[model samples]
Target: MAERKAFHVAVVGATGAVGQQMLKTLEDRNFPISKLTVLSSARSAGKAVLFNGQEHIVQEATPDSFEGVDIALFSAGGNVSKELAPEAVKRGAIVVDNTSAFRMDENTPLVVPEVNEGDLHLHNGIIANPNCSTIQMVVALQPIFEKYGLNKVIVSTYQAVSGSGTQAVEELYEQTKAIINEESYEPKILPVKSDKKHYQIAFNAIPQIDKFEANGYTFEEMKMINETKKIMHLPELKVAATCVRLPVATGHSESVYFEVEQDGATVADIKALLKDAPGVVLQDDPDNQIYPMPADCVGKNDVFVGRIRQDLDEVKGFHMWVVSDNLLKGAAWNSVQIAESLIKIGLVK
Candidate 1:
């Protein structure tokens, strides 16, 4: 008889938004865990976190936290990941980092599992979860790229406040209620939290996300562009993005314009392709008013794609609307999925 192997898993920044989701996903998926360690910054240490019907206190994450951990899921801020992810690795844990700190690192595999599970074999010690927006976009596009070939992609995102964290989500709810009651409120955390300007995210759409680069694209846009190329291994593919923040709290929606390499591909062909693509959900029925939307995608793990159509003029051009729970499929679910992939492919110890 064969014996089942269970892993010692650690969730870094366990109290944070995506961290909580990571724990939930692990529990929901019934991952094989011999032991689970919940870690957070010193500020969140001693906080109680409910996991798998048990209350676990989050410990202050330190270099020693990874001593016996087989896999560490990190959703902390970039600075936290920068300092501890390597420490976890040095201690023999494979770190699935959900931050930009290592996504562009040549040695770190920027993984989306569905698009580049094979890239997992190339990981040195860290596997990076691509940015939330980048994850969904690539999932919806991978099948298309596989069948028709892809020439260029341009994406405009309608993102949610949860992408910024709990504080932002609370602010959105408070601000909305305040406006309804005609109360004055101050804006503090949108577009870019640390940027010189602040904008209201409730009853508004902030056209910028992250700090703008000298090239005029916001940092979020650059992440989408670069991460797309890296994940799909299409460095020469033309990709552009404009990111915007909306009033929603959990899901992220993207309008993607793409040009396929194949000339005669039809809208039906694209829909047929995505309908069977792994990790993708097709929901496009215009006559029945069925289409992907942020409201309907909350708590779901599949990337919802809809509104597929051919360009008015360009025979090779097509458009799609991609939506997913930014915290789930976009971040937490993908990280866990990679960990699952690692186990299935015999990469994790």
Candidate 2:
């Protein structure tokens, strides 16, 4: 493989939680960088953030801020991406958006690098990263989707509060203390920040993760079901999800039941496939009580899969647990990985 000259890169929402992780991932990966511009909301502009031990000032992100950027990574929010992504594209920047604003767009490629890196070549100036939970799930499932053929999927997520934001993590800590001290506290954020109701996320599991759609699934659940189909390019694939926010702070875990098209696929077959799968760590040791867990997967970029077993009732069905850092593999690392794919495939100059 040959290396190309470093390209100019800009990160939109440089000061937010996921954005900070994106910057760190780019640094840790030693991504080629001729120039780096850190852009943020007006509220966070002018703040100084240390990157690779050097100070970089966050500037307000605007259409004009993308003038010379060859690649723009977006994670601020959907509204922000919806507004500025086109401008970035107009200025010759390839946008890797980490929001729902463009994930379902017919023209945009919804990618999970492990599952759909080839989708990068089809980008019309923008590529969409799948939802956090969806990214880790498909990474674990794609190998199966490829070898045996996937027929159906049912996932129940145990997502961490960090997926909500830094504030939700703060509220969880604050609420925990209030409870331990026998104090009273009102919940202000969790499940969904903008929803009409808020719930305690310290010791409780909130079954609803995002706003409810007319179809009765919360937005988060719909994101999983729909995005899974799109990423796997199996729109007719049957999928369902129930997303829940847990007290844990970083990783997202899922109990997934999937049925394959191939008959008589054994549990050992599934384990063997995942053991060598890309972006997946296999940890299925029941006798030793080894399995993937949120606390253990907090800082890792790889999705962890475990507790593999054949479903008793459904011969074609298998169940497994999948876990990954919502901040890293779920958002930042996935976004950065898409950018790297762009460079690797020569989609970006």
Candidate 3:
């Protein structure tokens, strides 16, 4: 908390989408960094990534690459995190991982600063970033939960193709043009890239985002259901999610239904609570037909909430729309924010 010098920093997936955003976020927030190391897989290694008007070479990540590093932000993938995260920790580097690898690990903290930043102190050199959908949802709902109490949550997500990766975004663009011109296009990356089936994502809505589990819900949907409970520390909270992929290139939108313990809680009360909540921007105005949209929230880090209203059938229920740039608030910004929290809480040395 004092006037400290910049620390040595590393980004594991510097060439990827969220990784690039992480680099930009570090520069934007003026995160203290005495040394910056850009790392990636063998395929992306040796590439040049620009930072602070200087070109930094990307190196293939190995256990030894973490030597002398202070904080490392990882977004490569689950397998990479599973393989290298402990290695990074072994080298004395605190890791803020943007993958699902260690999210459920009891030793690792799954954090969204606004929602559960206090958990960061318990990290044993690794902290997990919540799922993109789960981060925005909890950010919007936690204040309400604290004020009125919460019983259940039902969420339907309109996720963008970028959540899959950069290749999926390119596939969506190529597929859209092919469909518009009446040309042939093959599907290679959508719904699930490694699954047996791939669907056209351009100009089409795919009801599935990840592989199906034994219970018939997609892996992504289950992540929302399970991660929300863990992050909120409410194991008994009833949560259900339906995640779908849309043709959009960025941002994710959700229709969230939640039950409050306070009966007859009006829409105005909900709006008043969120209007001043940290990291939340209220945009509900039916008079002007104003509401949060994915397109409008593409580059912003704040969670946008709107369409607040009481459910017709249940006096204890309310409905709202939440939108956020999945790559930023959901992934990159959230990851960087965790690092910032580490500094604030004196966890980072």
Which lDDT values do the candidates have, in the order given?
Answer: 0.94, 0.92, 0.94
Which should have the higher lDDT, number 1 or number 2?
1
Ten consecutive residues with minimal summed lDDT in candidate 3?
A: 1-10
Q: Which window of ten consecutive residues has the lowest lDDT sum in model 2?
A: 1-10
Q: Which of candidates 2 and 3 is the stronger one according to lDDT? A: 3
Clashes of each: 0, 0, 0
- In candidate 1, position 85 carries an lDDT of 98
lDDT score, candidate 2, position 229: 92
Off by over 4 Å in 1: none
Ranking by lDDT: 1, 3, 2
* Model 3: residue 101 alpha-carbon error in angstroms: 0.2
Candidate 3: which pairs clash?
none
Mark the 10 consecutive residues where model 1 has the least summed lDDT. Answer: 184-193
What overall lDDT, based on C-alpha atoms, would model 2 receive against the true structure? 0.92
Candidate 2 Cα errors over 4 Å, as ranges? 1-3
